[model samples]
Target: MKKFALYSLFAMASFSSLAHAESVLSFGVDPTFPPFESKTANGNLVGFDIDLGNAICQHLKMKCVWVETAYDSIIPALDAKKFDAVLSAMSINEKRKAQVDFSDMLYNTPSVLVAKKGSNLQPTVDSLKGKTIGVAQGTTQEAYAKGEWQGKGVDVVSYQNQDFVNQDLISGRVDATLTDSATATAGFLNTPQGKDFAFSGKPLTDTHYLGEGAAIALRKGDADRVKMINSALAQMHKDGTYQMLEKKYFTFDVYNKKP
Candidate 1:
């Protein structure tokens, strides 16, 4: 009887340790995008996505760990087990769907062109002909520009992150940059460094490139974790937690009404 009790205690302790290990959810993020994920002056991650990820973890009783990753190589890193899921503002496109699974729609925003005021530049092959456009590496904007404008006399330059793209745009190395409207507004255009720039054209709506919306990305075949996150997201929506976080960052609803 004593030996059996001791074995039971050891088994329970081992199971508890395994459960605790499994309860930690690691999220990969590219901290360069503002209003979503970025580091404060003290290197603490702060933004809407960061808050949302923490809320989800709290709701699910899991520990959340953020791993900084480059935007272009985020997917590969996810597959390599560097992190369990990607909590960055990654879009849900067919190309990406083929590589990794994504949670339900988080939010949707339009992509627009930012150029110097009165430049009269538009996001078109003809309007931007012979002009240089900067885009972040591995972004849908990069894919769209490369596919639609690269060979049509438009010079599309790719940067490792959006911050670099915006920097070059300010320096006149690129005439314009195509990026999400929210980031373009909050991260650059609304700041003093981007005072000279303005949205140049109508938002791009090519679903083939712009994608459906942004969501948390997980490795393929991880349906259980995907369902868990989806459930947490649904709960966040139902309990008004999603709106609370959204109000913290944006004035309008970032989560699209349709999705």
Candidate 2:
């Protein structure tokens, strides 16, 4: 009887594992945001989030589909059930939490300032005092910049996209721009404009604003979906897969970190 029971338990465990492997889920993001999510010149959708999303799908033995949406509309679209979840590098925060659930954190990059190299202004908040600062609208960087810098009477310029914000800064229409430190480092530093620009100092983050890190956004009450995503993410973390991707895109480790 003991041997029979042991065999039965093993069979049940195997079946459970198989069941977990069969679950399918869909993901959404803005494909134009490079390094995170974007369409390759080859017309293939590729980015950090896309890679990670596919990883989750692989773990779940699920089919993964890409649904492109505007960066600002991602969360709202998720709430509208436009997709099963979001992997667009949306930062988890209180305001966002009220509308959607989140998976285990995938990355935690900090926000940094970018300015023309010849500008006397620094990237620090004080440097922007009374001067204009540009940020992509509907982002955590925008939240922090407007709350901290704009509240100080520093001019806060909100743009629909980072590329445009970068353009305005380059054209001298904006004094400085606030963006993800890693992105500013990656996108800006690699290009001529980035080389010509520099960070004011380091980046800043508080739990209230930056949150613990970035995660997959899901509609509220989707506990099952959230659980599946978190499971896949945790596995990635334990297996060193997330680390590999992080290193591939960013030299610095941004996973499960404070800043």
TM-score of each: 0.91, 0.86
- In candidate 2, stretches whose alpha carbon ends up further than 4 angstroms from where it belongs are 1-24, 118-120, 123-125
> Which candidate leads in TM-score?
1
Query: Considering every candidate listed, which one attains the maximal lDDT?
Result: 1
Return the TM-score for candidate 2, rounded to 2 decimals.
0.86
Candidate 2: the clashing residue pairs are 31-38, 188-194
1-259: candidate 2 lDDT, tens digit per residue? 9999997787556545644665556687776556787676788987788889888887767888878877888877887877888888788889888878888888888777778776767655677787888888778888888777777769898888888888888888888887877777767667886677887656777667766788888888876667667767888888988888877788777774777
Give the per-residue lDDT digits (tens) of candidate 1, residues 1-259.
9999997787555545543669898999999888898898999999889999999888878899999999999999999999999998898888999999999999998889999999999899999999999999989999999999999899999999999998999899999999988888778887999999999989997878888989999999887678778878999999999999999889887888332
Worst 10 residues of 2 by lDDT: 15-24
Residue 23 error, candidate 1, Å? 1.7
